[model samples]
Target: MLRIATCQMTSGPDIGANVQIAESLIRKAAREGANLALLPEMFTIMSNDPKDVLRLAEQYQDGPVQRIMSGLAKSLGIWIAAGTMPLKTDDPHRVTNTMLVYDAFGQEAARYDKIHLFSYEGQQERYDESELYVGGHKTVSFNLPLENGLDIRIGLAVCYDLRFPQLFRRQSGIDCFLLPAAFTTNTGKAHWEVLLRARAIENLSYVVSAAQAGRSSCGRAFWGHSCAV
Candidate 1:
């Protein structure tokens, strides 16, 4: 049996501040005996400014952000499903929203770029990520090796990707789906719990989610209910 911890966070544009909070929560999870911990999407920084994405986007395997996460996993002796971070892409103008998973030994385990970029146009709130993020094409999954000698298969997905069932269906025999998200207050209120429940019911698999809730540093409201089932 795997003990998992999903963190509920309220992040802002300050990368340093966000990382510190995440580290504290992760350490707390490890202390509480969580074998695996997941963070919310855009945990690095939920910026209202698009330039922050470009200013901070690092190459997939390189950069200070990646180094810190690897160290946290190794030193803490825990598995970390790192929430999505901005990754530099071939396109100089845009970056790929990427997720990185690290093993207890501080080694890279798997990587997934968010395939579904959110595009929502509400009367009050409008977001078009396509302008800043390059969509990812492939699905990704990895197995967690346990001391019990049973490896658990876990699939990877970012926030908006949860809206598309086809993405989850693409991975077979997944014991759990790791989702990291920061849903806008309006949309999340209408469908967050409903969708999460539906996904769990449809897949017959556990759904673990980390969320960004409340008012962010950017002053944007989020639907901050992190859940696992």
Candidate 2:
């Protein structure tokens, strides 16, 4: 079996601070012999203000986030399935919520932009990710070569995408699913675990999820139970 780890964090608006936390967690996971590590969505920044996210958006290849993840993967000699980060797009008002995977050698192996944007309105809270992010149009999957001379197919997805089973269904022959999420307290408490387990059972593939926990700089509380099944 492939050893994997998922990290939960209380990310804030400071990109540098968040990266440091992620690095520390990744190092811990590596020391424990984890072959792969998955981080939470928006692990580099979490803010309710659109300006904060926009200010932090960077080009996929040239951004500090990518550089940090790549260097960490290479240094630790482990694969890193980085969580969703804001990547600059053609539209200045919007960015892509993208996931980047790095191989042990620090080369980017695959990238998946989040396809489903989350929008919720309730008496307690309201959120509309579409205001800041442009949803991606494609499904992405790649193979991870294991030490046993076996290659495992991994499908990539982000938070809201977990609610859309059709997306996972489109990726056939995947051995596992990686979901990086920042689920709200209300919805996560009600649906997170059930949905994750359902995806694993229905697809007959293992599911790994990393999530943001506790309160964020935006005053939003996240459900922090990052897990795998």
Candidate 3:
């Protein structure tokens, strides 16, 4: 069986501290013989203020976070999926929630910008990702070449994309799907497991998800049940 690890995190507003925590977890996963490692959504920063994301957003090719992940992947000889990092886009009001994939050699292999924007409102809760992020234009997938001559195609997706099964339908050739979500406690209790199982059952593919759990620095709570289905 293929080995993989999905991290459950509680990220804060501090980017440096978050990265340190992520690196530690990644190392642990690699040491455990995980061929592929997945991180949670907003793994680097989870600030209440959207503007903070823009400030932290970095260009795709050159960024401290990207460099670090690439280096780690190469050193460990594993595939690292740096799950949603804020990326610089043309719109100052918005950032791209991009997932960067690095090969065993520390080379950039693929990238996926989160396509679905999240918008929800309750009597006491509300959030609109479109206000601070623009949707991605294309679907993203990559191949994981294994030693046994078995190459697996993995599809890429983020939090809200789970709500739209059609988006996953378009990724016909993928052998697995990676989802990184920061789902709230309220919603996670209501729909998280059902949705994940549905995606896997419908697509006939494996689903690896990492999520943020517990109360965050922003006072928002997440329901974390990171798992593979």
Runs in model 3 with CA error above 4 Å? none
Model 2 scores what on Cα lDDT? 0.94
Candidate 1: Cα lDDT at 153? 96
TM-scores for the candidates: 0.98, 0.98, 0.98
Cα lDDT, all candidates: 0.91, 0.94, 0.92
84-114 per-residue lDDT for model 2 (tens digits) = 8999998999999999999999999999999
Off-target runs (Cα >4 Å) in candidate 2 are none
> Which ranges in model 1 have alpha carbons more than 4 Å from their true place?
none
* lDDT by residue for model 3 (1-229), tens: 5788898899989999999999999999999999888999989999998878989999879899999999999999988889889999888778899899898999998999999998889988899998998899899898888899989999999988999999999989889999999999999999999999999999999999999999999888999999999
Q: After superposition, how far is residue 202 of candidate 1 from its true place, in Å?
A: 1.2
User: How would you encode candidate 1's per-residue C-alpha lDDT over 1-229 as one tens digit per residue?
Assistant: 7999998889888999998999999999999999899999999988878998799899878899899989999999999999989999889889988899999989999999999999888777789999999999999999998888999999999999989998888788999999999999998999898888888888989999999999986988999889986
Worst 10 residues of 2 by lDDT: 215-224
Q: Quote the positional error of residue 160 for candidate 1 in Å.
A: 0.9
